[model samples]
Target: MPPMADIIAPQAAAALLAELVRCPSVTPLAGPAGQGPYGEGRYAALLGDRLAALGASVEFREVEPGRPNLIARFDGPAGSPSVMFEAHSDTVAVDGMTVDPFAAEVRDGRLYGRGACDTKAAMAAMLLAVQSVLAADGGLRATVYVVSTCGEEITGLGAKALVGDGFFAGGRVDAAIVGEPTDLDIIHASKGSGRFHIETRGKAAHSSAPADGVNAIYQMAHIVAAIERDVAAALAAMADPVLGSPTVSVGTIRGGSQVNIVPDACTIDVDTRLIPGQTFQTMAALIHGVLDRSRAARGDLQYVIHNRPAYPAFFIDGDAPLPVLVARACREVLGRSTLRAAPWASNAGIFAEAGVPSVLVGPGSIAQAHTCDEFVEIDQVVQAAKLYAAIIRAYGGAGAPATGARGE
Candidate 1:
């Protein structure tokens, strides 16, 4: 069969990306999802139909009401190893975009729009790769599953739901490749995050009345100092070489009604990055420890804490089957392979935690993910399709690359 890379022309890849960009899938964080400007439902439906056209069995499994995961399965030989190509369907809000977020335009070989670089480019490439493979004269090298997940931006609710959703029946796929913009490099390590809110409460009083009010902002200073001075060092000490130190930073703070009145309440948002073995519980414990120490020092300190769900960090050995296979596939198409580590979390961590060996790779650059005028190089998208198809072809059959067989 002809190389799958040769199947999808640059124009087709660009057009598919244009269709995806034209659809507004910026996740509406609140309320039920709908086929509107802020939901993935519209985009999911479109992609589902495209997958169906390629002779894949398509299904929309809702992880939340109106927010569905579009899963497309292409069956190969009965006993062949199966691989999942997973990409997020949601993009960040396009509040201040320089160009029209839904206007998918090709300008100077760059496809400009929201999510064009972040992921839609990868999504487009993956679809074309699947098409090329299926169109080949010989049957598939391995079974393929193209999954577009929801809620990757705010929280990984979809990925969380995917763990035990029973989509794979009692068994699981042999490997998974998470689609994220990595300039086509392989990402095998990344940090997780636990984002939470911290608030300090106090009595409000008129500024003229001396000693009449306790300052909530002043109370918050102790807590912030504890986190920066006390907890930060401990996080640094436990750093991993690949992903570096897990860390925390106070992102936002709000307090005081005006300059005259004493503050009654103050709220601060904290973002914590975690390494392997850290979870939401651990994040809470670390914060709680600092709060307790602060309270001990200040007898009148009062505070409330809310720990949001965490996105787990992921680490796959460079020599692991999936990473190795993807690396080889990258080399096959790009003439070189680069294994990398990321500080930001992605769906890779979610799938890796579920016993599915996973790695991250795709077209475009991470720097352009949420920029004002987001764009991806047209050539990169085409290259990625070839790389993905190469991975699929090498991963199928008795001598496939990703099965992790020790002796064959």
Candidate 2:
């Protein structure tokens, strides 16, 4: 094995990204069999093969029957902690992109494709970095695990399943690094988010006889107005120094069966973003309290929260060892210090909540994520690979055991 600094190169990262982008692993939607642009099973298999070729022990963890996750581990010396590098394999739908989402085209220093920037680039860079680390005699003191997961754009089912399966059992891992498009920044915190459905009930009657029945639509309208006011006030009163404040918005609403009849039922879908220290139960209680107070004022209106959790938010302290290691690695390899907070949500929150000290680090810009012309700069890809190698070298050095290493 060669030294870590001499084993990685820019071209290697580009090649990996190109191969991944060509797979067209878009988010799955209900559609004809094998007709959607997502479902990254093929790509996962390809990556598994690559990991095996690099001497890593690979396992295909199936979260769903058709959707699989790839977990590959490179063994190091004994007694060191294991570090896990995590990334989502599935991408958001390329519904309105102007470019061919699967082309993997490179134009003007940017690689244009569906998952190129959102995350595939990070996966590629991480893989290449692992290869470089192996080439170097730096031998890991702890094992390094690379996980490509499913359902990041939707329910985070892959991550949830991994947690439920005891993947983090025995406390082998000291840290985790979630490869999101952070432009090489280290994200120590992220806002939590959840979706809710509010339903109001009332008696229906002919529109011509207003006094004969209750109007559920009117009841819902009042509740919606109250939510807007109450939620806005809550946000205004509390703001985090890093993740800002919690927010709520009504995303959808439906009511009424006919124009001439008074509607007896109405539903509103709300999206809520929570800062650290908040939870679904607490938010639900607050919303219910608002509704209860409003109903008391109205005398005849009632509502209930129906939506379940879409996802949860997580936040780690900025000064945690994981962030410290990641920032130091970035500065040493990329010549720049990294930021420590992300405004949006990602799977890192899940890992953090599960007791894994995880930091978000990767190539590309978040602005390009889920956008039409999604792309990652070639330079960022190369730099990320080098940074990953440096992290491995710093933690796993030659003859170091794989027992207590963190994956930040």
TM-score of each: 0.93, 0.92
Highest TM-score model number:
1
Q: Ten-residue segment with the worst summed lDDT in candidate 2? A: 399-408
In candidate 2, what are the lDDT values of residues 10-123, reduced to their tens digit? 556667788999987776775421465658688888889988988889999887766888899888777766788889999888888988898888887789899999899888
What's the true lDDT of residue 326 in model 2? 71
Error of 1 at 82 (Å): 1.1
- Write down the lDDT that model 1 would get: 0.85
Lowest lDDT sum, 10 consecutive residues, model 1, at 399-408
Question: Global CA lDDT of candidate 2, please?
Answer: 0.80
How far off is residue 26 in model 2, in Å?
A: 1.7
Name the lDDT value of residue 340 in candidate 2.
71
**Residue lDDT tens for model 1, 141-202:** 68899999998996687788788686654445888888899999999888888887989998
